[model samples]
Target: MVNDMDNIAGTLQQSLIQIITSVLTVIGVFILMLTISWKLTIIALVTIPLSILVVAFVAPTSQRLFGRQQAALGKINDQVEETYAAHTIVRTFNKEEDEEKEFNRRNHQYYQSAWKAQFFSSLMMPMMIFIRNVGYLVVAVVGAIQVIHGQITLGNVQAFLQYTNQFSQPIAQIANLSNTIQQTIASAERIFEVLDEPEMDDKIKETPVLAGKNLPKVEFKDIQFSYTDEPLIQDFNLKAPRDKMVAIVGPTSAGKTTIINLLERFYDPQGGHVYLDGQDIGSMTRDDLRKHIAIVLQDTWLFTGTIFENIKYGNENASDEEVYHAAKMARADAFIRELPDGYQTVPDESASNISQGQRQLLTIARAFLADPEILILDEATSSVDTRTEVLIQEAMNALQQERTSFVVAHRLSTIRKADQIVVVNHGKIIETGNHESLMNQKGFYAALYNSQFAGN
Candidate 1:
């Protein structure tokens, strides 16, 4: 695709025009040649199909080579993205040599594929020229003989030579345009391939009003799911009130995040249902469903913008005072004010101006500004300092006072006071209770908590 971008934009449209103009020129010149001499015109027309045959033979090969070149270029881009994104870890682990070798290998592969594609495309012109000139030589020789015998005029012979050049000129132009056309085809196919893919179901049902005291704010009943063919969550069941914090805890890749993904409708369960405020999540528009929720992820993201702008992202209508208040609640105000530009400083991809913890603070402040009806904290405090984490927790406590909240935490201390702590392992909820009750049960949660505190 990148390869296509480099070549397609500059020539595709122009080459299409060239092809049309050249074909018209060929036809007009052919008619003029016939008025001068039919014999010479026939001679010139004979080599054209040979040129067309050469073009036909090389086209499929050129297309195949271009495909390989694009694939290799995509791989090169992928490697570069991975290596640069993990630059710190790569340097720390001293894997520079291995990374460089991998990049060079991909670069070489791209070079090989590109070389072949260009070579095949490049073959068309010279072959057409050779065939055209051969016809040119034959015409000049035959016309010379005819002229000497007074069978044709010398003026006519000269005109025939010029007409012969004009006739083959369009064919030569076609050879050049062929390269652009092939690449444009390849690029267009790639683009439309993505466009042709199936999209998620996106029908919005008419939201019905509910009047019930027993409504589950969020519920997963008999949920069955998996990224692959196998079932991960065969019969999962969970229910939480409209105003409380429910924490999901588990080992890495033990399907804790998957639960949040399902509730958020990132992926729907193969069986059973996820409900929000007594309505099936699948039946609601994803945009409408997500509007009431705000998620603060472990990996914070801030675009190129001022601290004030970043804080106001979730609630673009928020006032300056509201942004300031949110920042203070998330304990980000102190550091933000200390910066050289204060709230006006921009932090972007470079990531050099602000620390990771500060970035997390900004995201938290943004979420706070939104004042969502439902909140999701995915290891939200993992980047901040212990003191900052406590402050953020306090802010979360205030936010959850009247809204539903789900917390995915690795640190047991972070969720000790959670209304419910569900211990997950092997894709199943092995235990559920508050901290003290789970400790009393001495079940999976107890074992996990004990392991974290072990040898302390």
Candidate 2:
């Protein structure tokens, strides 16, 4: 909220400064016109209201066009970003021509709107000049008649022409000012759209601090969730015992990751309750809940930093020895030692400096350094080669002992040794038992297992 207020205030201040400067400039021009001649001043004043009417008539249309142009440009930028980020995938799928066509369509829309805005804004200056010229003609004719009748001197006629030019100057300036003001307003509206969005509300009203020594059990009771109007989990229930490894296995789109999301309180369940230890999760502060849980995902993201700094992100105050120990346990220490600078090796942006397997190892090391009581491994080994997968599984086995762990995996070998395996299909738990028992039952789990190892 403080950030939002600051942004809004800054924008308003900038807009106001520009408006005031433009107004003062116009006022200065008006004063200069008054010094030329009274008759010419009156004639120039007539064009002031006319210019205002013209601007008022054209400003809205130009602003609307400009706003649309900006929005179209944003879409084009999004398309470009996505294409560049997924260049490899685009090439693999032979989607270059399709993507190019889409980009051209969006670019054309932007060009059209931009051209319209410029066209309207460009008309303002010419219209102002035309009106000023008409006023010039009128002043010259009237002043000549007055000079012949001895109502005004030759110098006065000359002065009237000068005042006409001065008055017309403000009209031209007003046109430019109108365009700028409209654009500023359009930009402000876009900025406010983001600032006005509601942030995640603190669920726990009271500040409840949990000690980092011992962790609590997690429970999901009759939990129902949905991304859209359609339901995902109708009535799901699960309990994760304290300091125990529990693995959840399911087919694709079985709400496996959704469970992890709920456990982390990224989104509240539409119906039912989630409890941590004995307290309802909603009753615990978000920070308190997250402090106890650490997750290592298959797609690891590492910022541009040294390997040491990346691991230190998990626990900023951790000593160097602690970081090394965690890395050694995750089997990442050997790789780090091989690097030119060991732990000091700087990772490229997006961690392109290392291979996929190495990146995953580094992330596992990060999670280990944090030493959370609860850990989540979401397809953590799915992206690596068979050799790396074996190494990560060994590290995972060491980490899971005496810790409440949730493992989601597609490989049957990874979960075959789990203490308990729950098979999920279409967001519902269809079977729950050890691997051997589930195979014996010959149900969904048995079928899935058979399909996975059919050719083996």
Candidate 3:
């Protein structure tokens, strides 16, 4: 599988050049051989179909074997990735030998399938050579009889022999690349599948929403969306005016994140529209729309780069002082300074170099540097302790002071001060009000809040 990917870069280059040059050579030589002797030309032409029949018979078996080999390789890769990610757990449980045995089993399966694919494909070239050799024998016997009758000159027979070799040469080359052709066909199939997929339609992109507004009110009007057979959001509606913190509290898979996906245009509603400043969001360039919004999700994504670079990523033009101030606001500056190179330290891809709480802090700091007009905090403080969450809440309050914000929280305590708290159950809104109003009403929000404080 590694070899397949390594060769992917050059597969088209070598195969195309070989096929084109070979085809052109065959065409030129074919006409010349015909003029030498129709009898000999017919013999060469017969070999063409015979060569094709050989490939047609052998190539499918090779392709099937290749597919099996790839699947086996994928399984081995999955096992290796799992072992690598959980190497510490394996050592803790003393399961390293067991893991090695499973890995060896998958490796052996891959070896068997890979050899079979190669062995079947390898038979094509030898069969092609045999076909051409038989054509050689036929040409020699027939040309000799014709030469004896002086029907064609000795030079013509000699030239025809040369033509015969040339005619079969391309066929031989193509046959030798049967395995490559099969792999190319398989790769092309997968690529075409993606290319043929449905894409977003933007008929209104010519005219944008929010032409002059840096910040616009967001609205979901009669929204209907679904991922599976049933609709997740049926007749959903909401209006979030500018400079207000709207908190959405719900149980797991209550469509909290799905709402975020719609706001960011990751998935368009199956029906109805999401509007910004009274205009449909579909009317704006998605990139232009997203530039005004900043999101800090629960899963903090930190790439392999310096801390300074990661902070600067939210706004490349941000001044060094701006990055420091943002970090301070998010309360990430203290731990960052404790690092060896501070802002210059490079983290691993998984960001395992830092604790999960620190990773969340850096992400929040990065979002602060963006200074966007709209903000999304999707369980942004979930990884932190209660004390740290309280600290981050202060930073979030400062960030949301003059921007429209949406906060999805599982912990009921985080949204106590929000201007409006929305309670979601299943796929629909169950309650909507402030912390005071919802508590006064004694509804779902009150129940949820009471459950949190029950022990106390």
Residue 105 displacement in candidate 2 (angstroms): 3.3
lDDT against the true structure, each candidate? 0.85, 0.83, 0.85
**Candidate 3 lDDT score at position 283:** 80
Model 3 weakest lDDT span, ten residues long = 207-216
Runs of candidate 1 with Cα error greater than 4 angstroms are 13-48, 137-157, 187-193, 203-212
Off by over 4 Å in 3: 1-7, 24-39, 60-65, 88-116, 151-163, 205-216
TM-score, structure 2 vs. true: 0.84
lDDT-based ranking, best first? Answer: 3, 1, 2
Clashes of each: 0, 0, 0
Per-prediction TM-score to the true structure, in the order listed:
0.89, 0.84, 0.86
Please, what are the lDDT tens digits per residue for candidate 1 over residues 335-430? 999999999998866667898778887888888899888999999887778887887787777667788899999888899989988888878888
Candidate 2: tens digits of C-alpha lDDT, residues 1-456: 232244446647875676566667667766775765666578767877888888888899988886776778778878888999999999999999999999999999999988998889788888888888888888888888888988878897887687567657755775766666666566667777887999887756442534454444887889999999999987898877787777898888999999999999998888888878766778877898999999999879997789999988999999999999999999999989999999999987777778899998888989999999899999999988999999989888888878889999999789888777888877888898888999999998889889988998
Candidate 3 lDDT over residue span 11-89, tens digit each: 7778878989999999999888877788779877889889989998998888788777767877898899899999999
Q: Model 1, clash count?
A: 0
Q: What is the RMSD of candidate 2?
A: 4.8
lDDT of 3: 0.85
